[model samples]
Target: MKTAADIIIELIEKFDVHDAGSRRAHGKGEHHKARVELNEAGKDIFGEVENAVVRLSNAATNDKVPDWLVNIKGCSVRFNHPLRPIDIIGINFPYFPFDSAAETLDVLYRIHFYLEDKSAGRFMDIFRAGGLYRDLGKILKWMPKSTDMDHLYYTAHSYGGEHYKMKLDYHPGNDRIEIYAEKDEHLIDYHPGPAVHLGSILINPHSTGKEVKYFDVLNAPPGMPPNGNLPLLRHYVYKRSFLRRMEEKLLDGKDLRMLEEVWAEEKYFVLSKSQRIYDEIRELVKKGTDMSATRFRELLDEAYALKYEEKHLRNYLQHVWGHFKDEADESEKAHYTRLSEHPDPEAVNTFIHDLAIKYKEPYILRTTMVKTRGRS
Candidate 1:
């Protein structure tokens, strides 16, 4: 029976808005006090949104606060929770500056339409305007994957110069561009043969050449990690090299095939009818910001009543919109209808539990045959 206003009221109550008032005191007479006040108001609105999400899920409270409320650098809020441990590791990249009116609109459109987080919108504004890491050591730490190998992983943006050594020969001066410090001695070794090279004749499970896979930054499943690698960096490091090799192979009249194959896999999650509430939130983002914060929270409450909030609402929606569109035949409808009729919570739970296990299982390739038929 709770309305969106009710849900919004509950969520806004959780946050101490007075915290903003005290924090602004430190700013004294500066504009920062005004900024703090605005942020506090934004946070209040966000609380309403968060409350709506909880109501829609119809689930118990969690110790981990939802990711949206988490403020990074008192600026951008994370869009959502990271899916995996590795997903938490973030990489710094340059964003196009927002200056012109068109540029500002373009940026906002991307954020509102695709990114779906206002705090993210703010962070992008600051970083995109030409920021720098002056004293590297104070901010970031570069630790090696192993003491033996030259490979390094970055901890923070300030110490990012540690990665400059690896790319010093090929791309000098701009230390931020190529920052994963690893030895680059064999960079040009991709070519034909069983040895996996860039212009290799054939690539398969047994091939030993380099392989490339592009991870979707925005469309990744909810439980997976966040996109940390810069798209431009990936393009420069892999796409450019791959394209060059592909052109070379084409000139030599070789048939091209997918070098790295991603086998289609189904990942599932079990949730009660109440948990499916995230769908409302997802749908809301697609809608323009026409609804006041109060109205959106109301829709969320009704949504939570239908499905128990589980971990995979985003994943489920992705699969449905992407794969099930054409497959919604009579049988599929019957299947959902049957579930609705009987509502086997245990069966759904079991299915999801099994799926989680399956997802966690890593791929292992077993060779049944080896081409002992050697040099041609």
Candidate 2:
């Protein structure tokens, strides 16, 4: 297989959204203009999806340094199914927390880059704040004949798993209700909360028995089946096995069991002191230099933490690989292909470039770099 970078670069060459040299538009970037104009009402939805991806990737790395990001085959197909389109988004950002509130706003800086990308105008409008409504309204009122309104989907994500839920006390007469948590009691104990809520699709990867019952309660109308049975919506859960992309699969009975294990041990340890690590990065960012002698100590501690995460991940993957090789299935084999090799910097760059093409928009890639004892 080509290195991740090679695949990413190839995708960028084919899609050509932006150039690394000048960050300038070099091709007819608005290839999917119709899709963007039509799906104006679902902008926030899309944002949510992207956010979730970022958060998941970070969690996979334990929110540490030596950061890296994930790359994939392509977006158009991964997201839209058979009719594949080249939609890829790369997220890379400093993992360290900002020193002050003002620095937090920097999170939006990458969005601006997407807004200015000529081709991305086809499906996304990063300018407006009231999400889909405000931006699409502006587009329609100003250029009524200039765009369509049908080809878009909404997405979302959560950082601490707490952000994806309802924040308001009262409903404002909106049709969108909070998707309730679901789980299988035979498998897991508590819900990881709802991480995905799209249109009518309510997905909770960490649901349990009572949670599954809860899902039925929220989705069904106030009535029992003619036979007095409850209606259950079509739902899937991850089966916790060594299969690759198992995380992407619908949560299943096995997955619930694994989640039960995760819940039991998650609080056992605070793997690393992240704040100390972040303080060092903040000093570097603010001054572009750290004058204090102790700054070196801080940097060393951060680097050590990163190395630990890298080794830990490698060890876990090694175990997973052994299990996968032992009892492989077709779906398991396919996932193995995607995770077959570890990602490197060049591969990562290509992945990000491809993501830009897939989304037809610019995105932030929060990276976690790591140095493993393996040959390229």
Candidate 3:
């Protein structure tokens, strides 16, 4: 039985032989067009049911993989029983390719040519920091094209538990490519079964899940779902939910500013606070203690009893106001005017406390009560 390392070594050897032959036939430096030739023997060894091809192309002169000849592979697979032109196999690279075939081979061979290794992990880290999908979009255009295939499938391992899969359909006569993906829940799995197609667990005989859903990539805004910054998406959702709660409460300007301050404070705590703080707060609220206006003031005072850092508070308020300024309506404008008047501190304190209870966001009560020496 050939291990993954063995398989990779075999494939590299085959690619070397083919590359040398191509260089000889086309004359050195003359073969500008990239080519992908399938190796049936290597495919069988790699446990691929269909043929796999070695794709040779010039790597982009960028920070990702500067000035190198890249050799990657894609499998040829037929889908649907009476297979139509939808058959395609997408291959995802584990890391950015090195500059030359020798450099690439050396890096892979050093890692025993395994897909998941420290080197591969480093490559993935760099790839993600460099914008995973954006870099992929550039490489996809350089790959060999086939008229027989209707879609190109690309897959990658994510830092999260799930994997990433993208299906790209190129226009018949142009450079435009339409991207699609299986439903988010089905795209990746932590405990993936032997055959998990999209989100359905195929190994279980009693499974009755419907076919996976796919959505057009273009429908989502740039830097949003399907292929965008997940953290940014999460933050956006949190902000929207927070804003909605504020609207429901009809919070005044001062009230909004206080909540925004606490939110900023909580953001800083994400790096230092223990899960215990979050858990304890959730449990405290769940116990259903009366969190009336007085109780709210008590919590606020307890969280920020010292001299409050007015500068930090003002900065956060301005930052949030800037975000909503363009979208502010007449009512919002009036609220801002009221807030600018600086309502009584006791009233503002009560409002902040009430908001904490109402929204179940205790972190908002935890503000920097004291201004440190030498700081504004």
Candidate 4:
């Protein structure tokens, strides 16, 4: 049976969207290493936020479409946390037409359809489900028309279910904002919304030598697991898109460091699981041992098993909490249920991290996800 995810992948392949399985929908964009400080209000919502990485892209019809011509803009912010990082994704428009990922996929179809047919009549379908269609004004308003991101208001319409819903908004900045490079976090939240200001993004540009880093769309904060059909299908598209992009980069002989780092940290063999095994191998190297292929293979296998345990254990704790809670003592059960239902946003990741690292020490690593910038 062709599930929604299967259909999404098919559409991605059909249009040959460059950034399909990644960035949610913002494929063509720039990434920046940003410093995020919470305002008094923001601090209340998101405590002690570390600096972050941001992706700013044009939510245009295609890669060839100009940023200003696009009706929407996409921004994804990833706070720097060794484990259990938070990802807040949003668009320039105040509200998204669709409430879920499936709706977003429909928007994608509408976009490609409009582009191919070059007909507003088709795109402005009154019967179109969710987004733009029902609101004729919005349909025209959200067409690609932004002059630039500096003055544009980008919003994160993300919901961590009912328990954790936040409004992370960016204020409208002027030409001076873009004119000056490396604008700090305070400049744009220069405040964008009614809610607490959610820091600013310093869009980092890359030149010849610099490396381009990408945020992992899969890594959602605890208590905010992106489950359900929409997320499933959306993630499928993201994964496939990323893999395709990586493959293309490989073929083009582009630097693969970023991909390697993403895989090491985010993918199957995460840093925590593999780092110790790597350290063991390092010790072998320091001792001047032969370090045969068999030994290396064994270490990799160990890392693989450890990673499997990490994944399965996380799943078990989050989903099968009821069964385990039944067996545990009162305090343990309460703790499990509290976290399972409504977790303390600040502590959940650390708690999960502690559990995952019960045997292994936490592995903290950083990667530029790029190389050099502005090479002549």
Maximum-lDDT candidate: 4
Clash counts per candidate, in order, are 24, 64, 3, 17
How well does each candidate superpose onto the true structure, as a TM-score? 0.23, 0.19, 0.24, 0.55
Give the range where candidate 1 is weakest over 10 consecutive residues by summed lDDT.
Answer: 367-376
Candidate 4: worst-modelled 10 consecutive residues by lDDT: 367-376
Question: After best superposition, candidate 4 residue 78: deviation in angstroms?
Answer: 2.1
Expressed as tens digits, the lDDT of each residue in 16-96 for candidate 2 is: 333222111111111111112113222342232211110011112122222223211110101221211112221121011
- What would the per-residue lDDT of candidate 4 be over residues 1-376, giving only the tens digit for each residue? 3445446655666676444323335655666666666556445444467566666667553566666666567666776655445566555554334446567667668766876786768667523856354566654664445456643333323334432323334443411111111111221122222343444444334322333444443455433443233433444455444544443332232324444444444322323345456566555434322323244434544554552244333443463233233445576656666665554423444443433323222232121110000000
Q: Which ten residues in a row have the lowest lDDT in candidate 3?
A: 24-33
Count backbone overlaps in model 3: 3
What candidate 3 gets wrong by more than 4 Å, as runs, is 1-69, 72-166, 171-173, 184-310, 319-376
Residue runs of model 1 more than 4 Å from their true location after superposition: 1-287, 305-341, 345-376
Q: Which stretches of candidate 2 lie over 4 Å from their true place?
A: 1-314, 329-376
Kindly list the per-residue Cα lDDT of model 1 for residues 1-376, writing each as its tens digit: 6423233222332332212211210111111000111133323222111110000010112223332332111111111222211111122211212223233333333433333345755545533322222323322333112211112122121112212111101111221111122311121111111211111011011222322222222222222211223321222222222322232232221112222121111112211232334344445434433323333334433543444333344334333333333545576556544544454545433333333323432221100000000000
lDDT of 1: 0.24
lDDT over C-alpha atoms for residue 356 of model 2: 25
Q: Rank the candidates by lDDT, best first.
A: 4, 3, 2, 1
